[model samples]
Target: MTFTQNRLSSERLAQVSAGSRFSYNRTQQAIGIVHFGIGAFHRAHQAWYTDRAMDAGDRNWATCGVSLRSKNVADQLTPQDGLYTVAERSERGTHLCVVGAVQEVLVHPRDCNAIIERLSSPDTHIASFTVTEKGYCRSADGSLDPDRAGAGSIYDYLTRGLALRKERGLSGLTLLSCDNLADNGRQLERLLKAYCAENDAQLGEWIATNCTFPCTMVDRIVPATTDADRTDIMEILQVQDEAAVVTESFTQWVIEDKFAGPRPAWEQVGAEIVSDVAPYETAKLRMLNGAHSALAYLGLKAGYTFVHEAIGDPALRSLVEQLMREEAAPTVATADGQSLPSYAEALIARFANPALQHKLIQIGMDGSQKIPQRWLETLEANRTAGRQCPAIIAAMKAWFAHLRGDNGPVEDPMADRLTEIASRTSDAQCAVALFGEGGMMPRIWQVSEEKLQALFS
Candidate 1:
């Protein structure tokens, strides 16, 4: 390619420096679209989609990456003039692609002023977040979480920024939440509204009257990039890059058609912009994410090191496929997509991909936060039907076992829950309460504690 990494890095301020192959600077040409929680998944998926949007020249929807905490955004993105790399891989082969949609980057507290200014700017019309499922600060029924006290860091920032924007007579921006949580956008609105209500009633009213939070469903298996991925890209593409990313071949984004400013023609570039994201969200959460959780827990318990290892194991892999059949397929409700079984089969094939190297621990890191979204609902669905979910039930059993810390010496990092459960080992009832019953599967609280103890204990 004519635009080489050396040529690009010499001229630009690199954002995140991971030696990834897709780092370059086409960012100066675009406008800001404020983004929070700028992680690997955002770079590999949303940024990639925006990069595709940028290809047409009329759309100037650039991204601004802001960190909530010490989210390690600068550790990767700032060295080579805001340049980084993205490495996309699947079973077929690999490709090196550069994403420069994130035009500006900032870390909070230090760059708090900059973040607020960007949010208040009229030109900055879209505010999207991938702050994680736990980050939403929402309630269980998909509304704003009422539990938190007034004006936390994120909420404070939004409150102040929106007030400033209103003082300048600017309209509200589109707030898109890309977390795996259900009704992510609406949930964000709840949080935003709650914050605004406590701090400024006018701002709250303005947000209710003006802001548009579009519900979205995004799916992709974007793995964290590593040093080995750098070598692989260098060997294959014959290019040296400093922030390459790695992800599976499959990617899907379903956005609601609500934008305050001009958005990229993502629909033109293969993204589905739908009216109701519910069905899409359900399918992805239940089938794809559910299977993923099942694999991570079950795979680890079976002594497998990585996701590929689990898929490679005939017994474990068969067990996962069975879960797909019994639990995942029936609950999936996407109205205009392929059948759930077909999707699960395809996902299984992707999971078996040796090159992607997705780690079980990486997938299993936030099991406490992930399982409710992925598996619990389906488990309940199976219960309602009175069906035999030996494999899924067994996986849940293994997950609880994992949480209980029976298998290892190091106390699996994912076993913090197990440690808590272990504390109540003497009192089975208290222990059972930890899992919301049987000390396992806290998300499925409706299920009887006695039954969970019978199954898991």
Candidate 2:
């Protein structure tokens, strides 16, 4: 069948492999989740888990995805009847499954009332988010920026939705944050409350009294879906799935056990429901994400395009291992029975997975917003302990070089300012200029001139 004529949909489910088709009745499942920032990561990770739960007989937890800015995802999934494929690729092979957990996709502002109506429904038990760090519109101090909390922001939509729920006398929902932020749930609660407090004090009181924000630590390596991925998915499913996502087989989600309402049996599908997600989040952020950023900048500088290729280089591989082990690992206080060494080694193996084709450039984007949590915190923690981090320093140098367009164009929130700083300042003084007082980063590094020269050399 041709691409246009054989689009994947409810009617076309029988055409795909039996195992890839939804095991449960998709039509009978109700939408219990209103997810913001329905991007590739959300699809390949959270929605995949939700699909697994549904397959295991947990219904009424299907997701309604909200695209805050773009209509691209809505355009892709709506045409396919919200049935998209997730191709889990690895060195072994590819495993394709059609995720039916996302029942609908709504573009915000245009469908704002529909979204609010969904949120106010008693059946909707959760409002989750995968909006990247910048989507929070946080100031440097990590508080919500009131100026950016205008109409059409997630904060605006959520506040309005929650208020409607309150007015409708519906039970409060759990606001789950699946992003890579530190103490994600608490941070989300704090920011949302701040927004509510400023705009509607009564709504803030209602939220404080009723809603729950459960912190989550979500880990997955989902690369941006390319045309090649779409073609491969088409071959496997025998139907066109434009919204198909490609990811590594490995996935982990650690959630704080607190929730305002009933939720899916995500634990049965391998999600960890724990009291504290801090240790897990810190470990993943420092080890996996820090190593990833290092690989991206260093790998690009070394002329490597993909993660597996970069880790295949001995020097880069050793550097990443040391960054995770010697630098990042020490700062992470692991949970009981959690092994940092094993996690780091697993990350290396995952990065070396040839079939995933995770791009260096994709990881490298938004470095200015990402580096603080991924690398700088590790650096600061090591500094506080009086331990040296040559590996992190090397990575930082690579990042600084990256800012100067050593590899290619910078794709960061602070791109223009950072590039300008890199252009005007000397190598020895650049770090100071960027991390010093009035700089982007929180803490300044105190590296000597000799070491700085050695870095460039």
Candidate 3:
């Protein structure tokens, strides 16, 4: 059966699944947060949390989801009145929930002006972003990369919206970054300020005085939706849900508790609000995300398709252990009540979950943007201390090979330059070229070319 508003009712909720939970009063929910990048992960993780918060009577926290790059998500969700299904698949069992936390959905190209107005409104106290790493438009030197960001960048939209808000004499909004990059909130704030400074210094001052960008660490294993997933969701719900998301049962959100205005009681729903999110941010990036990237490039090079398949390989598993225990763990400054070893074990279990087919290619995408925090920073630290990082180097080498079409096709902002170097240079020379004068790698990391070249050798 087709899932439509007419077919959906209080009685129809039972038809979806005996245990599925949903809200019938979605119409009463007000949009308080404007979330960028409403992709599968956002739907599964942040939206799921917001749904739980709304269930607990946090009505003003309903999200207005905006697609910055494409209209695919907006189109998929609009027909269903911003309703979607999220299935938590784990070893224990499968649990389904229909998330109604999104009060409205908008595509940037079509509703650009409307989006500005929505975000600038007094009711919207927070603007959360999950625009992946590349969305920030940072160049190699951690500055705003205008060439990559172009006109449709998030910076462009956000700065313009904030300028409009200032023009309207409105209060500042809290900017939350839920991307996997280390110190994500700080990164966004820097980029946003950089862009604003270049265009409007006055607005930059307003941002500095009024706004706050809170760092966040979000952890969840959410695979891209597949046909089989859709089929299963339809079977369970007795209707088609175009925007259905599948994810692991485990989820965590660590946020810096700094906001300019009123905000949701996200802490009430398993989200840890901290005074300084740096320690937690550093740990997750180095441990969880760092290991995930390692597995992706290494797994692809070893001819494994899924993360589960990759982690199952004894040699690969050993490499992952080495990455977490020897390399990543030493670099992380463990926060209070945090255990690096336990986190590593939990990550291994999460990666090895056969029920969730997390794709290596998905993890391997946007390597240029992902590597600085995930590997390069640690590599630079190790190099500075005269320490060798075989596992980290191996992952980076796999990434270079990935760029060379050795593992697979490249999906990166710097694909052209990386592929050019890979196509022209030999294995050993590839590292020198990437790390050499006028290369993208050097923009992010300041390392000796000789050491980098040795890693390739």
Candidate 4:
């Protein structure tokens, strides 16, 4: 494979075609949003939206991304001068667009002080996060874990930044969470307030009086970019972009219409700013994410490599459809004028997109962090309503089987603990050991031995 030595940068923009490059003047843009977890999802979703908003003449919302841990993203984007490609893939074809929404990428701790400065700046009105569920460092019950929420964590940085903002007499910032967590923005506020109260009461009080954390529902299927994706994108752009992200054509962002200060004209660029985001978020978390997780473990176990392949299989397709329509959808309170049936059908079609090679194992990673909201919430709801979710039960069993190495090595954060429990306990006892009294799950989420045995049977 011959490599494209010409890297994607601002200078190379002149060589690229008109429609593919950013129409807005990149040099004139100001960074108003500092985002955490600068991964493929963020680049493909939020940054892409911001890029579109810029194209529509909103110049101040360009993002300054911070990678909390690895500098891999920084290494990818820094050399490219924060320029990257977003390839929107679908059954039709791939549409490539160069996104210049990110002005800079910073790595935490090393660029810690700079990050805080960026966060505290008056220009930075929104501090957004896409740090996955585990990044919050919450315990099973969802409270902030003191050990994990210390220095170098997102909470610590925000507290320090907010403190500095207060000292500088700048207005409060909006803490926007774009993760899949239910009530993500509010959860962020609660966790941050807890952290601040424990460390600095004054800061906590100020945050309570000033800042706003609005719930948001972000949807996009951005698979991890493979070598083929990079090569394909490079072929299109005629310049190598290591930071290019390939995703499905469908994208949605529903944010609660609450902000501490001015924000981008995101609504103009297809973002939904509503009074309440609960119904939408719940539907998404339960139906889309729950089905994704189920498909991941189940598909991997069934020897399917990509989502399209698994979704193509009639049995797997039926299972996913049942999981979404019967088990997950019933738990969601439909938003005003929102059709759950249509949404579920659209999700099915999205999963079957042949152009996007979404890996099952990629979605299966961090199952411990994902399932509590994805599957467990739906399961708990059904259980409380005296309705059994057989599909969810099957998925749960599949997850357990996955943990036991039936689907190869587990990639969960609690891999050691989970694998230990799965190995030591019998099939009937596995559910009890994992979800029983004093188990990994919360006390309220206890499972019976009979249920496990029935599932096995």
Lowest summed lDDT over 10 consecutive residues: which window, candidate 3? 2-11
User: lDDT of each structure?
Assistant: 0.71, 0.87, 0.83, 0.89
Tens digits of lDDT, candidate 2, 234-302: 877789988999999999999999999899999999999999999999999999999999999889989
| lDDT comparison, 2 vs 3, better candidate | 2
Locate the minimum summed-lDDT window of 10 residues in model 4: 441-450
**In model 4, where do residues sit more than 4 Å from their true spots?**
1-3, 444-457
In candidate 1 the C-alpha lDDT for residue 193 amounts to 77
Give the TM-scores of the predictions, in the order they appear: 0.87, 0.96, 0.95, 0.97
> What does candidate 2 score in Cα RMSD to the true structure?
2.1
- Kindly state the number of residue pairs that clash in model 3: 1
Give lDDT tens digits, candidate 3, residues 173-211.
899899987788888888888887788899999998989
For this target, which candidate reaches the highest TM-score against the unseen true structure?
A: 4
Model 1 global lDDT (CA atoms, 0 to 1): 0.71
Alpha carbon deviation, residue 250, candidate 4 (Å): 0.4
Off by over 4 Å in 3: 1-18, 443-446
Instruction: Name the better of 3 and 4 by lDDT.
Output: 4
What is residue 277's positional error in candidate 3, in angstroms?
1.2
Task: Estimate the overall C-alpha local distance difference test score of candidate 3.
Answer: 0.83
The sequence of per-residue lDDT tens digits that candidate 1 reaches over residues 152-204 is 35577777777788889898888888889767777677778777766688889
